[model samples]
Target: MLLCWLLFIPFIGGLACWFVSRRNPDSNAARWIALASMALVFLPALSLWFGGDFSLPSHLSASPDWNRELSVPWIQQFGIAFHLGLDGLSLIMVMLASVLGMLAIAASWSSVRSRVGLFHANLLWTLGGVIGIFLAIDLFLYFFFWELMLIPMYFLIALWGHEEYDRGAHMRAAIKFFIYTQTSGLLMLAAILGLVFAYYSETGILTFDYNQLLGAHVSGTFGFVLMLGFFIAFAVKLPSVPFHGWLADTQANSPSSGAADLSGILVKTAAYGLLRFTLPLFPEASAQFAPFAIALGLISIYYGAVMAFAQNDMKRLISYSSISHMGFVMIGLYAGTFLALQGVIVQVVASAISTAALFILAGQLYERMGTRDMRQLGGLFGRLGALPGFALIFVVASLGMPATANFIGEFLILFGAFSVMPWVVVVASGGMILAAVYALYLMHRVYWGTPQGQETIARMRAREYAIMMALVVITLIVGLFPNTVLSVTQGTMNDISHWFAAGVIAASQAS
Candidate 1:
């Protein structure tokens, strides 16, 4: 019911936007229609968060359980169902998705004048698919939405992106994105089917339901292999080191809104999958894999920070910064403690908003100066009025400044991870230094030295101001009162943490 409508509104509205465009090409009608659609989607997400019992009750089983669910048989012969569920974890994610979706639309309004309808149609569709990802409880259904989301994003980059001063820049980036994600998706699909068949062999029940499959016994070498499949898929999506080739290129070329969705929400899905599926689905394998995973998190942190410092392109710099921020998130996830997990959730939201605001700022700079090369940007700080100051605040926030959400998240992640992997946390903390170096360097190059661009600088418009300020307010709220998110997600994090603990115990007993 409520869950179904959440998915329905954005998808249908996407089509409506296309139709609106068809009727009147080059009109603002399509933009408003798309905005309205995103608005409609937000209402339901709000209701679900405020109106539902988000906590995972103590009486629930060892498996992570949903607080509210709706199911209808879809492929009975194969035991597939159109299952949708919501818990505190997903409730917060859905709400973030909707809020960012609207802001992305607002950010795009003036920049996408040529193909307003098509641009927004893709936007809404991408948001719809993301929402579906958050809600789908059936593995088959989840994979469907997962792949579904990427298509519209391909169109977004291919059609509206800025990489091409030449003919095929956007196409190259889009193709690379498609190939990378699609290949990873195939690997994930193989693993999902592997799990299903594994369960069927043990109990003679063919099912793709998350809860049912969770109860199936999966361990040993074969279980480890399947877990690797799932982990690789999530890691690539997380764009962990050695597998992050596509991220910088895609974000560098993408339109502001596309980059926003990519940095803010799309990447966050990888973290969600790790939390919701990777650890819980194969806890023993995940626990066994923690040390290596923590090492990789440390690598991503320094790697991203170093690359961001070296980059001249604004979008690429921000993309790499995202990699650095997600590194902390990765550490929290693998730490497998309540405090660390709590930090993971907070960091996810905070990082998304901060990165999104930067992308939006990049777009604004392009609109004024017509280039994102930091070499060509300097001393426009005074010329652009408060934009320089705004950029300063966001840059500081990106570096995990106190009273901002990133600080709270990074602090908790370090605090919790220290208990389990003291040496790793100690090494990873060096990334914060790198973060400050690049962040301040970015600000200095773009705003302090001298106005290097040939074009005139412009002040922030009402629309742009609104978009940035809204993100600013959200980040401040999360930073000032993280308890709102922590309280909502506590029960579920407890369940997930406990599940990993149980897995470790069970593995020890078996050994």
Candidate 2:
């Protein structure tokens, strides 16, 4: 019941926000509706954080078990149910949704003047869909919400994004996002259908339930094709290298607020999907392809870092940096080591914190300078004072400075990668160097040298500082004592690790 309420609260509130315009279609009602409803969603998530157990009572860490769950027959005739659940994997994500959702509302507090009600409406709905993705155990429900998320986002980008985005920019970005994910969505649906049918053929049971499909048998070629379907869907969202073409345009044209949600929470769904759906669903294929996948992660790291160094536009640079960060996340995930999996958990949380912080700060910088060009940005460190220093901390943390959370994540990833494949680790190290180059270059260009006039030097606001400081404190605390996250995650990852090991051995024997 708590799990169901957690997902439904935002949805019901989002619908109510749409009606805010009826009494007075102004943005205030919409904003209030968004804020108030999101407040409701937070309660259930808080239960998991402080009261409910984040893990099972067992000694091992990783498992499919969720600490809180809700289930009821939705389509009993077809064996589908309104099944929803949460474990360490999704508990963290829902918590992120609540926090970032609140902050994004804050970011848009004064920035979005037009269609205020509509904006919050879209924002709340988008989150509802994301929460659905995290909790839905039914395949159909998962895909339904997956597509549900796409619509509100399309509106958010096309309607309220940067004015320079003009008319077609939003349409173009929205359409591109739709096409990429929709195509991949179709592929994933196919795989889901295949799994259900495969289970039915063997056991005379037709169900879209995850538990039922887990040990269903399939041939190598079959698993390979199905896994490809799932992988492509996850990869496009991860926006891994070749499939990443949509990210830059979306970030560049969309409102900074929309970009925050997209970068901070939306793209993460792909990584989450990879862990929850793709790898676990097709373990044999995943194990068979782990080495190749690790190579892709390595490639994305260096490629994104190098490209980030070349970009002068603030949004685009961070967009590319997101790519680089997810690269490490992907590598660690595929490594199948305990430490590496722990690194993935830290990396996901830290990446969201650090990258989103940079994006928000960049938005502030843009508001000040009225430009994102490196050449136009010169030292305002004296004028900006503490902000530049704070920005530097985020930058170095992003660059993986030794004591920062980013360093802890990278260290674990490298250590885990080395244990599995030393040569891959050797190559992946170059990404760290490239990250330094780009991060420092951006620092020098944006915050160093002389002041480019005194035009863009407004001191940081209390609200923005509060939001950023929260992110800062989280990075420090999580980095210093990683066990805070690791302890809860250890059991879950170990269960997942053993699951994949069996698949790897099976695949090897078959080959």
Candidate 3:
């Protein structure tokens, strides 16, 4: 019941915000309502984090253990149910979504004056769909949420995005994003259907239930093809290398809040999907594909870093940086070790916080200076007061500075993956050096050079300061005591590691 409410609150609140805005367009009622709704969602997830029993039993099985689960019959003939489950893995993600959702609202508070209510409605709806993606265990249900989140995001970029040079640029970006994701999504849908039909043929049970489908006998060329379908979708969402074409433009044009969601929360879903569904559903195929995935991860790491260094647009720089950061996540996922998997979880959360903070800071700079081009932005360090300091800290964190979560995440990922794939880890470590170069270059280009102009920039507002401080605190805490997150995700990661390892052994033995 609580799980159901967590999924529905954002949607309900979005509608409520829409109605309230229609009645009182000028009032802050809609904002408060959306915030309250997000609060409602966050509170329950936090309680689960604190109070729920997530420990695994001494004896493990092929089936996973859930902290909470709810299933109701929806399509009996097809073996589909409205199945939802929560585990430590998902609990952490849900909490991240709720917190980021609220901050996105706060970020958009003043900048979005027109259609304020509608804008927030889309924001909340987008978040609702995200939570659904995290929770939905049924493949049918997962795809439903997968596609659902894109529409509101399209609206967010298309309707409210910045249009500096071209009026239609934002719309074009939105459409491109939609087409890329939607087309890849359809491929995943086909793969899902193929998996369901294959399972039905094997066991004479037609179902989209993930648990039931998990044990389905899928192998050979057919299984690999289906796995590719899922992989392509997640990769595009991850925006890994070749499929990352839409992300820079999309983030470059989107409103700040929208970009924050894209980098902070939305991309993490791809990592989650890979962890939760792809690896578990088709472990053998995933094991076979690991090497290639690592290669692509290497490409994204270097490519994103190089592109970010060359960018003058601050938002585009951050967007490309996200592609680089997520490269570590890809390597961690396929590294096939317990420690690397744990590192992947930490990296997902830490990167989300640090990257989102950067996007928010960029938005603030844009608001004050009316530009995000780094060439046009220099020596505002003294002029912007604490904003430059905030940028410096997050920029350092982005490069994986110690005492920040980014450092802990990247260190663990490289350290853990080195044991399994020494050569790959050796190559990936160079990305950190490149990362520092870009990070320092960003600071030097934007805040350390000669003053761009003598404009009177406003100091950080209370709301803005609070947002940055909150993120900084969280990053530091995770950096210092990562066990806070690791403990919760340990049992889950152990189960996945064991499952994948077992599949590897089985495949090798059969061969």
Candidate 4:
């Protein structure tokens, strides 16, 4: 019931916001309604997290576990159920979604003036769809939410995004985003049908339930083919190396709030899909594919970092940096160990917060200076006042500085990945050095050089300060006691590792 409410409130709130905006076009009611709805969501999500048993002992049982769940029959003919569940894995993701949901709302308060009602409506809808993605345990339901998320995001970029001296710029980016994600989604849908039909062929029982599908017996070439469908779907969403063409454009032109959601949570969904679906559903295939995937991660690390250095656009630089950071997540996931998987979870959370903070900061810079070109900006330290300090914090965090969550996540990923693939991990580690160069170069160009003009922009407002400070505090706390997140996910990662190993053993024996 509570799970339903978490999903329901945002959608209801969006309609209410639309109504409110329609009635009072000049009022700030739409923004407040969106913020209030997001705030309300945090309570239920928090309760779900604390209500669970965090102790590892609880996981000793050999039974499937779910801390909170709601299952009801839906679409009986297709074997789909309105299934939702929360475990340690989903709890953190939901929490991140709610937190960033609010920040994205707050970040839009002043900037989004045109179509205020419509904008807030889209924001809430996008968030509602994301919450669905995090909680839905049924594969069909998961893919439904996956496709739902993109529509509002396209509207967001198309209607409210930036256009630097070009007509239809935002629209083009939005179209590119739509085409890529929608195409990937079609691939995922095909894979879902394949898996369900495969299961029915063997057992004569049709279902789209995640747990039931885990027992699927498809193997050899057929299993490998089904796994490829899932992997490609997730990989496109991950926008890894070769599939990353759409990200830079989308981020570069998107409104700050949209970019925050994109970098912060949208991309993380891809990582989550890999963890939640691709690996567990087809573990043997994942193992067979790990070497090639790790090589791609290494390439992303170097490619993203180097390309970031070449970008003159501030948003593009941050977007490329995002690619590099996610590369570490790729390494940890394919490394195939409990420790490495834990690091992947930590990296997902930390990278989202840190990257979102930078996007928020980037928005702030654009608002003040009227441009995001690094070359045109200079010596903002004296002129912009305290924003430079906050920007510096995010910049250092991006570079994996000590005492920050980014540092902890990267260290663990590298440490765990080293055991399985030392050479690859060593090669990927070079990203840290390149990260430092690009991160500092951004800082040097934006805040430490000569001012571009005498255009005096306002200092950080209370709302902006609150947003950045909250992100900074979160990074610190997670860095200091990563166990806060690790403990919750430890049991889940252990179970997944076991599944991977068992599947590999089964596949080899069959062959």
Candidate 5:
């Protein structure tokens, strides 16, 4: 009941804020209501770190059951359940969602003036859906939350995006984002139903509890196709290459808060889904497709960096940076090593922080300077030293600079890849160089390149400095002591590695 409460509280708060803010938008109640609600939501997520079983089961230390699972029947007829669970792999994602959800609300301060209630409604619901994604263990529940996130996000962009982006443009961007993810999201649902039906037919029992479905072996093309369905769904969200068209629209034009959430948290759900479901559920197919997936990952890194180098708009550049970082996450996933899996987790967290921080900086700039065009936005490093300095940290981190959190993740990912596919590792290394190119280019162009004729909004305010500093500290602390994360993550990664190893051994024996 308590775990479920933690999941639903944000949603309940959203609905309450909607009504209350509508009645009294003039008062601080609306903001406080939204803020307090989100803060409360953060508590339970953090509690999991200290309270739950955090160890691999000794009997199967290599493949322990994920900790603190909560399950109950919801739709028995379809084999669905009100199933929610977490292990080391998921708890970190949950914590990330909670922390960022609050930050999204904080970033909106003073930026969102019109339709305040409605905007908070969209924002809070977005967080709620994200929380749902982190908690849901049932396929149906997962898909339910997956689609549930779209509506609020769509409204966030179309209604609150910059006035300069005309209605048609905003509508087009919103619709494109919705259509792409929604269409692919359904394909994943179909795949889930197919897997469940197959399991029922074989065992005379039915369930979509992820635990039950684990290690449900299949052979031939069916296994491969099922894996494709899961991969495409996750990829659309990861927005890998051809699947990436939707990301820039959402990130570039969205309201600051929307952009923050999109970059900070929403994109993460897809990466989280890939690690939690796609690879583990269909290990053989994932392994089979490793080479092609690694190729896509490498391309995303170089391509995203190159594209960012060419961009004039700062927001769009950050969006491409996300594409590059997420690409590495995919690389980590397919690399299939314990260290690599942990790297994926670290990459997701680090990338989300850096990208989110970049956007928040963009929002602050937009609020002050009235534009995001990097060409018109120079001399900032001189006038707004602190702000540029903060931006530089996130920028360097995004570039995977050593002593930042991003470096640790990228290091493990490349090292892990070298073990299995040395050539792929070499190709991926180019992305690191490309990252430096873009990161430096962005720094030179926006902060130090040339001024836009005036030093409007010359410096960052305390609020802006505070938020950016918080993110900086998170990156540095984690960067310096990655072991804090690596310790908790090792227990889970070992289990996943054990499972994949079992499957691999089976394949080798049959050979």
Candidate 6:
């Protein structure tokens, strides 16, 4: 029941915001309503985190032990159910979404003045869709939420995005994002249907229930093909390497809040999908494909870092840097060790915080400076009170500075994976050096050089200060005491690792 509320509150609040805005376009009612709605969702998730029992059972099983679950028949003719479940993995994701959603609203409070109500409605709806993606247990429901999130995001980018010289650039970026994600999403849909039909042929039952389908005897070429479909979808969403063309443009053009969501929350959904569905559903195929996935991860890491180093646009730089960060997540996902998997969880949460903070900071810088090009702005460290210092902290965090969450995540990933894939870990380590170069280059170009203009920039506002401080605190706490995050996600990560290992063993024996 609470899971349903968590999923529905943002949606209901979005509609309410739209209606409230229609009635009072000039008032702050819509913003407050959206904030309250997120608060409503966040409090429950926080309670679950504190109060829920997430300890790993002494005896592990093929099936996961969900802390909470709800299932109600929906589309009975097609064997679909309105299924929702929460484990530690999902609890953390939802909480992240809630926290980021609220901050995104605060970040946009001043900049988005035209359609205040509609802007927030889209924001809340996009978040609602993301939460739905995290919670949905039925494949059909998952796909539904997956597509649901994209439309509002399109609106977000197209409607409120930053317009440089060309007005249509944002729209083009939005459409490109939609087409890439939607087309890949369709492939996943086809794969889902193919799996369902395959199961139906064997058991005369047509169902999209994740638990039931998990036992579906899928293997051989058919299984691998289905897995590819799902993998491509997630990769595109993950925006890995070749499939990542849409991300830089989209992030560069999107409104700051939209970029934060894109970088922080939306991309994590791909990692989640890989963990929750792709590996678990077609473990053998995933294992077979692990080498290729790791190779792509390597490519994305180096490619993103190189591209970021070459970028003058601050947003594009951050976007490419995110690609590099997610590459670590990709490697962690496929490493198939308990430690590597735990690192994936931490990296996902930590990267989301640090990256989102940077995007928000970039947005703030743009608001005051009237540009995102690093070449156009310099000597900001002394001019912008507190903002530059905050940027420096997050920038260093992005490069996996010691005592930060990024370091813990990357260290665990590399160390854990080295035991399994020493050569791959060794090669990936070069990315750390490249990351430092680009991160520092970003600070130097934007903050340490001669002043491009002598204009007096406004100091950080109260809201901006609060948001940055909160994010900084989160990054440090998670960095210093990752156990807080590790403890909650350990059980889920362990279960996933076990499931994948069993599949690996089965595949090996069969081979």
lDDT of each: 0.89, 0.82, 0.91, 0.87, 0.82, 0.93
Which lDDT tens digits does candidate 3 get at residues 399-494? 999888888888888988998899999999999999999999999998998886787589999999988888889899999999889888888888
TM-score of 4: 0.97
Off by over 4 Å in 3: 452-456
Q: Put down candidate 4 lDDT per residue, 111-230, tens digits, no spaces.
A: 888999899899889888988998998999999999998999999999998987577888999999999899888988998999999999989998999889988876778778888888
Task: Please report the TM-score between candidate 5 and the true structure.
Answer: 0.96
TM-score head-to-head 2 vs 6, winner: 6
Candidate 3 residue pairs in backbone clash: none
lDDT of 1 by residue, 403-470 (tens): 99999999999998898889888898899999999999999999898665545467889999998899
lDDT per residue as tens, model 5, 241-266: 87999998778889877898898889
Best by lDDT: 6
TM-score winner between candidates 2 and 5: 5
RMSD of each: 1.5, 2.0, 1.1, 1.5, 1.8, 1.1
User: Which of the predicted structures, 5 or 6, would earn the higher lDDT when compared with the native?
Assistant: 6
Off by over 4 Å in 2: 25-27, 54-63, 163-167, 454-456
**Pairs that collide, model 5:** 378-450
Candidate 5, residue 112: the lDDT equals 90
Question: For model 2, how does the per-residue alpha-carbon lDDT over 375-451 read when each residue is reduced to its tens digit?
Answer: 77778777774678788988999989877889999899889878778988888888888898898888888888977
What is candidate 1's CA lDDT for residue 385?
A: 63
**Stretches of model 5 off by over 4 angstroms after superposition:** 61-64, 165-167, 450-458, 506-511
